[model samples]
Target: MRLLLLAVIAALPAAAHADEAAERGEWLARQVCSNCHTISARAPAGRNPRSPPFSAIAARPDVTAGTIATYVRQPHANMPDHGLTARQAQDLAAFILAQKPR
Candidate 1:
Protein backbone atom coordinates (compact mmCIF):
# COMPACT_ATOMS: atom_id res chain seq x y z
CA MET A 1 0.00 0.00 0.00
CA ARG A 2 2.85 2.38 0.81
CA LEU A 3 4.52 1.68 -2.55
CA LEU A 4 1.29 2.26 -4.42
CA LEU A 5 0.64 5.50 -2.54
CA LEU A 6 4.16 6.71 -3.33
CA ALA A 7 3.72 5.89 -7.02
CA VAL A 8 0.47 7.78 -7.16
CA ILE A 9 1.99 10.75 -5.39
CA ALA A 10 4.91 10.80 -7.82
CA ALA A 11 2.59 10.82 -10.80
CA LEU A 12 0.52 13.79 -9.62
CA PRO A 13 3.22 16.35 -10.42
CA ALA A 14 3.71 14.94 -13.93
CA ALA A 15 0.03 15.28 -14.76
CA ALA A 16 -0.06 18.79 -13.36
CA HIS A 17 3.05 19.73 -15.30
CA ALA A 18 1.58 18.39 -18.54
CA ASP A 19 -1.53 20.49 -18.00
CA GLU A 20 0.59 23.54 -17.38
CA ALA A 21 2.67 22.90 -20.45
CA ALA A 22 -0.39 22.54 -22.59
CA GLU A 23 -1.74 25.86 -21.33
CA ARG A 24 1.49 27.67 -22.05
CA GLY A 25 1.65 26.04 -25.46
CA GLU A 26 -1.83 27.23 -26.29
CA TRP A 27 -0.87 30.78 -25.41
CA LEU A 28 2.30 30.64 -27.46
CA ALA A 29 0.49 29.20 -30.46
CA ARG A 30 -2.15 31.90 -30.36
CA GLN A 31 0.49 34.59 -30.13
CA VAL A 32 2.87 33.23 -32.74
CA CYS A 33 1.49 30.48 -34.96
CA SER A 34 -1.84 32.21 -35.21
CA ASN A 35 -0.30 34.62 -37.69
CA CYS A 36 -0.10 31.81 -40.21
CA HIS A 37 -1.57 28.56 -39.01
CA THR A 38 -5.06 28.14 -37.66
CA ILE A 39 -4.38 27.89 -33.95
CA SER A 40 -7.96 27.59 -32.75
CA ALA A 41 -10.26 24.61 -33.22
CA ARG A 42 -13.13 26.93 -34.15
CA ALA A 43 -11.22 28.44 -37.05
CA PRO A 44 -11.75 26.80 -40.42
CA ALA A 45 -8.66 28.26 -42.11
CA GLY A 46 -5.45 30.04 -41.33
CA ARG A 47 -4.35 33.45 -42.56
CA ASN A 48 -2.04 31.60 -44.88
CA PRO A 49 -3.88 28.97 -46.82
CA ARG A 50 -0.78 26.81 -47.23
CA SER A 51 -0.11 26.48 -43.53
CA PRO A 52 -1.73 23.46 -42.00
CA PRO A 53 -4.19 23.88 -39.13
CA PHE A 54 -3.17 22.75 -35.67
CA SER A 55 -6.03 20.25 -35.72
CA ALA A 56 -4.71 18.70 -38.90
CA ILE A 57 -1.26 18.26 -37.42
CA ALA A 58 -2.75 16.78 -34.28
CA ALA A 59 -4.72 14.28 -36.38
CA ARG A 60 -1.65 12.90 -38.13
CA PRO A 61 -0.84 9.30 -37.11
CA ASP A 62 2.92 9.91 -37.09
CA VAL A 63 2.86 13.11 -35.04
CA THR A 64 4.40 13.04 -31.58
CA ALA A 65 5.77 15.53 -29.06
CA GLY A 66 9.35 14.55 -29.88
CA THR A 67 8.74 14.81 -33.61
CA ILE A 68 7.10 18.22 -33.24
CA ALA A 69 9.86 19.46 -30.94
CA THR A 70 12.46 18.44 -33.51
CA TYR A 71 10.55 19.83 -36.45
CA VAL A 72 9.95 23.21 -34.80
CA ARG A 73 13.61 23.54 -33.91
CA GLN A 74 14.66 23.50 -37.53
CA PRO A 75 13.93 25.84 -40.44
CA HIS A 76 11.55 24.63 -43.11
CA ALA A 77 10.11 25.81 -46.37
CA ASN A 78 7.98 28.95 -45.98
CA MET A 79 8.05 28.63 -42.19
CA PRO A 80 10.02 31.17 -40.25
CA ASP A 81 12.49 30.11 -37.56
CA HIS A 82 11.04 31.22 -34.24
CA GLY A 83 14.11 30.00 -32.31
CA LEU A 84 11.89 28.39 -29.69
CA THR A 85 13.48 26.96 -26.54
CA ALA A 86 13.28 23.24 -25.86
CA ARG A 87 10.73 23.68 -23.11
CA GLN A 88 8.61 25.94 -25.28
CA ALA A 89 8.76 23.43 -28.09
CA GLN A 90 7.63 20.66 -25.77
CA ASP A 91 4.82 22.82 -24.46
CA LEU A 92 3.77 23.64 -27.99
CA ALA A 93 3.82 19.96 -28.88
CA ALA A 94 1.74 19.16 -25.83
CA PHE A 95 -0.84 21.75 -26.83
CA ILE A 96 -0.97 20.49 -30.39
CA LEU A 97 -1.23 16.87 -29.34
CA ALA A 98 -3.97 17.73 -26.87
CA GLN A 99 -6.19 18.59 -29.81
CA LYS A 100 -6.12 14.98 -31.02
CA PRO A 101 -9.59 13.45 -31.19
CA ARG A 102 -10.48 10.89 -28.57
Candidate 2:
Protein backbone atom coordinates (compact mmCIF):
# COMPACT_ATOMS: atom_id res chain seq x y z
CA MET A 1 0.00 0.00 0.00
CA ARG A 2 2.86 2.43 0.78
CA LEU A 3 4.50 1.62 -2.57
CA LEU A 4 1.18 2.27 -4.31
CA LEU A 5 0.81 5.57 -2.51
CA LEU A 6 4.35 6.60 -3.49
CA ALA A 7 3.70 5.72 -7.12
CA VAL A 8 0.52 7.79 -7.15
CA ILE A 9 2.39 10.72 -5.61
CA ALA A 10 5.09 10.55 -8.24
CA ALA A 11 2.49 10.42 -11.04
CA LEU A 12 0.54 13.30 -9.58
CA PRO A 13 3.20 15.90 -10.30
CA ALA A 14 3.56 14.81 -13.90
CA ALA A 15 -0.19 14.91 -14.34
CA ALA A 16 -0.29 18.37 -12.85
CA HIS A 17 2.47 19.56 -15.16
CA ALA A 18 0.57 18.29 -18.20
CA ASP A 19 -2.60 19.94 -16.99
CA GLU A 20 -0.77 23.22 -16.45
CA ALA A 21 0.81 23.11 -19.88
CA ALA A 22 -2.53 22.37 -21.52
CA GLU A 23 -4.27 25.11 -19.61
CA ARG A 24 -1.59 27.65 -20.46
CA GLY A 25 -1.71 26.64 -24.10
CA GLU A 26 -5.48 27.00 -24.27
CA TRP A 27 -5.40 30.33 -22.47
CA LEU A 28 -2.76 31.76 -24.76
CA ALA A 29 -4.54 30.60 -27.89
CA ARG A 30 -7.92 31.94 -26.83
CA GLN A 31 -6.64 35.21 -25.39
CA VAL A 32 -4.13 36.09 -28.08
CA CYS A 33 -4.43 34.13 -31.32
CA SER A 34 -8.11 33.18 -31.52
CA ASN A 35 -8.99 36.56 -32.92
CA CYS A 36 -6.82 36.12 -35.98
CA HIS A 37 -6.01 32.43 -36.13
CA THR A 38 -7.94 29.21 -35.68
CA ILE A 39 -6.08 27.02 -33.23
CA SER A 40 -8.68 24.29 -33.01
CA ALA A 41 -8.39 21.00 -34.84
CA ARG A 42 -11.77 21.76 -36.38
CA ALA A 43 -9.99 24.39 -38.55
CA PRO A 44 -12.66 27.01 -38.31
CA ALA A 45 -12.00 29.91 -40.67
CA GLY A 46 -10.28 32.99 -39.31
CA ARG A 47 -12.36 36.03 -38.34
CA ASN A 48 -10.01 38.20 -40.35
CA PRO A 49 -10.09 37.38 -44.01
CA ARG A 50 -6.40 38.10 -44.40
CA SER A 51 -5.33 35.94 -41.51
CA PRO A 52 -4.43 32.30 -42.10
CA PRO A 53 -5.70 29.33 -40.10
CA PHE A 54 -3.41 27.91 -37.42
CA SER A 55 -3.12 24.68 -39.33
CA ALA A 56 -1.92 26.54 -42.40
CA ILE A 57 0.59 28.46 -40.34
CA ALA A 58 1.84 25.27 -38.73
CA ALA A 59 2.09 23.53 -42.09
CA ARG A 60 4.81 25.84 -43.35
CA PRO A 61 8.10 23.95 -43.31
CA ASP A 62 10.14 27.10 -42.78
CA VAL A 63 8.22 28.12 -39.68
CA THR A 64 9.66 26.16 -36.79
CA ALA A 65 8.53 26.38 -33.17
CA GLY A 66 11.32 28.83 -32.32
CA THR A 67 10.45 31.00 -35.31
CA ILE A 68 6.82 31.11 -34.25
CA ALA A 69 7.78 32.15 -30.70
CA THR A 70 10.12 34.87 -31.99
CA TYR A 71 7.48 36.21 -34.37
CA VAL A 72 4.88 36.32 -31.63
CA ARG A 73 7.30 38.26 -29.42
CA GLN A 74 8.21 40.65 -32.24
CA PRO A 75 5.34 40.88 -34.68
CA HIS A 76 5.37 42.98 -37.83
CA ALA A 77 4.49 46.67 -38.02
CA ASN A 78 0.88 46.04 -39.02
CA MET A 79 0.35 43.60 -36.19
CA PRO A 80 -0.48 45.17 -32.89
CA ASP A 81 1.62 44.13 -29.92
CA HIS A 82 -0.67 42.18 -27.59
CA GLY A 83 1.82 42.78 -24.77
CA LEU A 84 2.31 39.12 -23.96
CA THR A 85 5.14 38.27 -21.58
CA ALA A 86 8.02 36.03 -22.67
CA ARG A 87 6.64 33.00 -20.88
CA GLN A 88 3.21 33.57 -22.39
CA ALA A 89 4.70 33.84 -25.84
CA GLN A 90 6.60 30.60 -25.37
CA ASP A 91 3.46 28.88 -24.12
CA LEU A 92 1.51 30.24 -27.07
CA ALA A 93 4.17 28.99 -29.43
CA ALA A 94 4.02 25.55 -27.90
CA PHE A 95 0.26 25.57 -28.28
CA ILE A 96 0.47 26.59 -31.91
CA LEU A 97 3.12 24.02 -32.68
CA ALA A 98 1.06 21.34 -31.05
CA GLN A 99 -1.57 21.74 -33.76
CA LYS A 100 -1.13 19.16 -36.50
CA PRO A 101 -1.86 20.01 -40.13
CA ARG A 102 -5.47 19.19 -40.90
Using TM-score as the measure, the top candidate is: 1
> Which ranges in model 2 have alpha carbons more than 4 Å from their true place?
1-19
Local accuracy of candidate 2 as per-residue lDDT tens digits, 1-102: 999999999999977775576569768788767787777775455588677676777788898767877888786875678877877776776667667565
Check candidate 2 and list the clashing pairs: none
- Residues 1-102, candidate 1, lDDT per residue (tens digit)? 999999999999999999999999999998779888987676545689999888889999999999998998899888999999999999999998988866
Question: TM-score of each candidate?
Answer: 0.84, 0.70
**lDDT for residue 1 in candidate 1, whole number 0-100:** 100
Best by lDDT: 1
Q: Lowest lDDT 10-mer window, candidate 2?
A: 93-102
Please report, in order, the local distance difference test score of every candidate based on alpha carbons.
0.89, 0.74
Superposed on all Cα atoms, the candidates' RMSDs to the truth, in angstroms, are 2.1, 4.5
